[model samples]
Target: MILHDFLPSGNGYKIRLLCACLGLNVTLKEYDITKGETHTESFLAINPNGKIPVLELDNGQCLSESNAILLYLTEQNHLTQQHQSALLPADPILKARVYQWLFWEQYSHEPNIASPRFWLTHNAMTDLKKRMLPDRIQQGHVALKLMDDTLAQHTFLVGDAMTLADICLFPYTHVAEEGGAYQLSEYPNIQRWIKQIEALDWFIPITQG
Candidate 1:
């Protein structure tokens, strides 16, 4: 498998981290989004959306979208009575709960946290973007509160074990303060959860070159 990705991206990092945890090997093809490499004709052919973290299989099939790729790569790791997987649950209800968090992360969390972080890091905080910060911060806080409250009572999002839900939410939430507009210190449970993820065996650190 070949992974076309931007190293600094949380969405891309999710895949890298999962691969590390699962001991999966994939050849990585890095792209510098700042140079408009993702928008090139060839990349667009692989992913019409022109996004990073496009996974091309040995058969030439391609999969895009970070969460979707996570599901695909970890399919074999899904829960089974004989083999309980920490990455995915076997019970239907538990699986649904994982999906729920994944959806929420995309709709409520990523937009509020990840989008702002990207813009703040890549583009100067001009008057227009500055005006949008307050609302973005509020939405991010709301998402953080939800995660904090849930994590306070449970070790993981859906069940006693870590699942895809944590992977989906971790990338953006961990670095949410990078833009300097938000501070994660407000959510103690979240901070604890981040530490737990970091301590996992075979965990991969997200880095930029």
Candidate 2:
């Protein structure tokens, strides 16, 4: 399989992290979104949306979207069962909760947190980024505080062990301060949760050295 992605992106990192945990040997095809590589005709043919972490399977089929790629990768492993446990739950009610947070990460969390980090901490500045500062920080803190509250009660997003929701959310939240938290200094639960994820052998930070 071939995985097309931008290395520093959390969305991309999620796919990579999952593949690593599952022991999938997918070939890496790096793209520079900042350089508009995904907009090219060649890439669009694979995914008209031109998104990163597009997975080209051995059978010549393609899977786009980070979460979708993650689900696909885990489908056949013992981790497959663990996958549903950690990422997708078997119970309809529990699964709904997992989906809720995953959706939140994409819509509420990523936009406010990831976008700002891509603009600020990574030193990729633009006028739009300059304009987004106050709003981004405000919304990001809201998301962080919400996460802190939830995590104060649960060890992971779903059951007692790690799940898809935690993996999905980690990339952006782990670097909240970089985007604009100034200091999520009081969210002790979040800090503790970050340490837990970091302790995992499969954990890989989006920005690698």
Candidate 3:
């Protein structure tokens, strides 16, 4: 398998982190999105949407969307294990909960937190984005608070054991303060959660392939 990704991207990092946890060996194809590398003709052939983190399988099929790739990888792993994988539970209710968090991250969390971080840190800010920043930051706090409140009750997003939900949210949430849009110190539960994830043996930094 090959992961077409940008190292700094949380979306890309999601797949990388999961592969690490699953002990999967995947070749990394790096792209500099800042330089319009993903928009090139060859890259466009891989993903017409021109996004990074497209996972090309051994048979040459490509899967886009980070959470979808997470599910695919976990499901594939489950098939081999022939039992419930801690990353994605087999029970319907538990699996639904994991799905809920993944959807929420894209709709409520990523736009608010990830976009602002990209705009500010990558020098991609514009007049419109400047006007949008305050509201985005406010919503980001709301998202963070929700996660913090949830984590306050459980060791991971869905339950005591870590799940795909935690991996989906961790990338951006852990580095949210980079663009000054957030202060991680304000979310103590989240801080503790971040530390716990970082200590995992298979944990890989966002920049690691």
Backbone clash tally (model 1): 0
Model 2 / residue 61 / CA error / Å:
1.5
Native-referenced Cα lDDT, model 3: 0.94
User: Where does the lowest 10-residue lDDT sum fall in candidate 1?
Assistant: 77-86
Candidate 2 regions with alpha-carbon error over 4 angstroms: 76-86, 122-124, 179-181, 207-209
Instruction: Tell me which of candidates 2 and 3 scores higher on lDDT.
Output: 3
lDDT of 1 by residue, 1-209 (tens): 99899997999999988888777788999999878899999999999998898999999999999999999988955444432455777678888998899889889998899888988998856787788989988988999999999999998888668888998888898999998867889889999999999998777888832
Which pairs of residues collide in candidate 2? 86-163, 86-164, 87-164
**Native-vs-model 1 lDDT?**
0.86
TM-score of each: 0.93, 0.88, 0.96
Task: List, residue by residue over 99-165, the lDDT tens digit for candidate 3.
Answer: 9999999999999999999999999999999999999999999999999999999999998888999
User: Which is superior by lDDT, 1 or 2?
Assistant: 1
lDDT of 2 at 161: 72
Deviation in angstroms for 120 in model 2? 1.5
Among the numbered candidates, top TM-score falls to 3
How would you order the candidates by TM-score, starting with the best? 3, 1, 2
